[model samples]
Target chain A: MALDGRIEQAVVAALALSKGADAPPRLQAALDHAVFPGGARIRPTILLSVATACGDDRPGLADASAAALELIHCASLVHDDLPCFDDADTRRGKASVHRAFGEPLAVLAGDSLIVLAFEVLAQAAGDHPRRAVDLMRILAQRTGMPGGICAGQGWESEAVIDLAAYHRAKTGALFIAATQMGAVAAGQDAEPWEELGARIGSAFQVADDLKDALLTPEEMGKPAGQDAAHQRPSAVAEMGVAGAVSHLKDILGGAIASIPSCPGEAKLAAMVRAYAEKMTPVHLSPVRG
Target chain B: MALDGRIEQAVVAALALSKGADAPPRLQAALDHAVFPGGARIRPTILLSVATACGDDRPGLADASAAALELIHCASLVHDDLPCFDDADTRRGKASVHRAFGEPLAVLAGDSLIVLAFEVLAQAAGDHPRRAVDLMRILAQRTGMPGGICAGQGWESEAVIDLAAYHRAKTGALFIAATQMGAVAAGQDAEPWEELGARIGSAFQVADDLKDALLTPEEMGKPAGQDAAHQRPSAVAEMGVAGAVSHLKDILGGAIASIPSCPGEAKLAAMVRAYAEKMTPVHLSPVRG
Candidate 1:
């Protein structure tokens, strides 16, 4: 199966585990809505690609880790769009979870998905107990406080912000989880993958900054220029649009170069290059200028 | 050290793990505020007591599990008090996290704590990998969907409710985790302890129903009659105050009887009897009448 297909299947199966006869239909529907028709599926793709690069010895564990990462990403998006936060109306060209299904269910759905991520990892532990523990640690570290996505969100409330730390926790953490967890799932050392993950995560954040700065809501499929409106520290805000774009290029280059020495190093590098091309803004073409 | 003291230390240390120079001060404060001065500390107490009854072989893992359970409980309370949910202004006789730090911080705090729970377990895995996996599974099952606390919260949104399933998910799930995780942490078979946990959990819920229906907000240190106001399914609503009180007694009796044959079985029974006495409403006293 294709990477996206596997990820989708794993996600569906994970969510299905929660579907009881007595479960609130609305919460289940909201969860389905949050997951299906995902954004880029970039995190899971990176995860699986890395796992495959490292032999992909445990396909089931890899898929579960990838799905869990994606679920956490989706859940963060749902919560971020809540009225208290970004209050975003549209996500992936549709109404945000809260807009579509009241705030309470949105909160519940997000919470459920977070728990589901751990549950998926735990259930997959039957085959590889140690790897399961490692996956859980990687996911949890990247999702929680200090240097995780939660800290990334918490940084917004602070008076001063460190752009690198903020971006890392907000965006880089999950990417790190992807690469590290992918490696771990494939029975490889996780440390070697961290640099590559960090680079990709940094590049992704810069690309996001660029899109937020330059795109319209219709073009982005979500609210644009939100960073400025929210007074959130952004790469574009810290380094001007052109500078941010240059930084993105530099980071992607570093990402491609940072691929660890693995059985599938060449393929991993190619994957990074492909992501770099995809993330590069089309309007930045010299001919357009 | 005593169980409560150990739990307090573990909780303090767990929250401390999230504290960094860059962490949002408000978020750190809110996380601390949510956990400290905790109400009852009943879950962890039960967990530790069960672990003790089962030999307390791995004290660190047991403490971590106990702390993780309490953190999950604390996170649930923070989310439950959100404006979109209960919108309660007070918890444990003080302002709720959302009320004190705003909704965004409250949400972030809750998310961070949830991740912290698993992170604590993962960190403790070095000493006992298999037990850590078991702890993660137990915690996830009790906290997430299908049968976890998330499912418990989701029950509120349903058109029709199954009181048994709802109470089990909402209340019984954590108690089950407490017993099962305790046993797992102590290297004992967790299944034997499930009945005891279930009975204790059911008893606690019934007692809560009685308190909510019969007590005032001041007396409860939090909003009373919330279940009735929210139209949530409650034992008192289903069985009435007197019947619920009777049910509480029955559950307590079953809890005492359900003690597994552990070395500390007598001590565990004594603990249950003490809780039963504590849960019995004061007004029910013949002298008071």
Candidate 2:
């Protein structure tokens, strides 16, 4: 199966237990609502691509890793859109989890998903114990504080922010998780995959800033100009749109170049190049220009 | 060392990564605030006790399981005190996470702690890979949906609530985890330990309801009559304070009787008896009466 199909299947399996007859219907529905109709599925896709590049000897573990990374990503989005944070009303072109389900269920949904992500990895640990352990550790590291996305969010509350560290953690952590976990899932060294993931994450953040600064709410399907409204630090706010766009191109180039010595290095580069195109808008596409 | 000391040491180690200089200062503070000055440390104590009863060959894994369970409990309390949920201003005799650090930081702190729980388990995997995986899976199951605490919270939102399931999930889930995970940490079967945990959890919930209904805010160190205020399901409300206290006695009796045969059965029973005495109020003490 393709990466997309594998991701969906794995996510379905991970959520099956929660959707049972005895489960609370609304929370189960909220779980479904948060995950389904996913946008891009980029993190899991990168995870699988990296795993494939590293031989993917344990396909089951790789699929679980992919699903786990995406679940964490989804979980973050749910929490990010809560009233205390962005108060975003829309996500993936639909009502945000909090908007659709109310604040309590939204909070519970995000928490459940985070727990479920780790649970999925542990469930898949039957035969691939070491790899599963590695996947959980890496995912937890990227999901939590000090160096994870939670730390990234925490940076926002700081009186003075270090833009670089903030972006590295808030934006780059999970992308790094995707690559590192992917490599670990396939029995490879996780360290070598970090650069590629970081670069991809940095490029995406820049691209996101460009979209928020340049696009309308209709175009983005959620609130736009949020960074400006919230007085958040942004690449586009610091660097002009043109400069941010250029920076994105540079980062994507580095990402492709940093594929490490994998069996399918060329294939992974091609995949990154494809994503680079998708990430760069057509009007200012580096490839088009 | 005793279970209490082991639990504290393990929790300290788990939070070390998040307490570094680089972490968001407020978030680090919030993490410490939430976990420190713990209420009873009852859950972890229960977990370690069960592990010891099962012949704990791996103290490290037992410690991790204990800490992980406590972290999950702390995370839940942090969220429960959020404005959207219980809107609780205090917990554990002090300002709740939200009150102390504000809403955003509280949310992030809770998320960070939840991730930290799984990470603690994975980090302890080492040579105890199987036990580690079991621990993570069990912890996640109790933390998340269907039968977990999240499911317990979700039952509140439903129009038609299953009272038994609600109590089983919200209060009983982690208690079950404490016993099941304790057994798993000691390389024992988890199923047989469920009844004891369930009875203990049920007793705690009743005792909590009794406190909420009877005690003043000064006595409880937090809000009182909350269950009645929120119109939440309460054993005291349903069964009356007298009947609820009696039910507490019955559950404690069952809890002690339900202990599975183990190397330290007598010791475990004694510990349960101690908790039973603690759980029952002076006016309602079954032993005194």
Query: Which candidate gets the maximum DockQ versus the true structure?
Result: 2
Model 2 clashing residue pairs (backbone): none
For model 1, the local distance difference test gives 0.87
Tens-place lDDT digits, model 2, residues A114-135: 9999989999997878778988
Chain A vs. true chain A, TM-score per candidate?
0.93, 0.94
Q: Ten-residue segment with the worst summed lDDT in candidate 2 chain B?
A: B280-289
TM-score of chain A of 2: 0.94
Candidate 1: stretches off by over 4 Å: A223-233, A237-241, A286-289, B284-289
Total backbone clashes of model 2? Answer: 0
Q: What does the interface RMSD come to for each candidate?
A: 1.2, 1.0
TM-score of each: 0.96, 0.96
The docking quality of candidate 2, as DockQ, is 0.82
Q: Write model 1 residue lDDT over A15-88, tens digit each, in one string.
A: 88778876767888989989988887989999999999999999999989998999999999999999999898
Give candidate 1's TM-score. 0.96
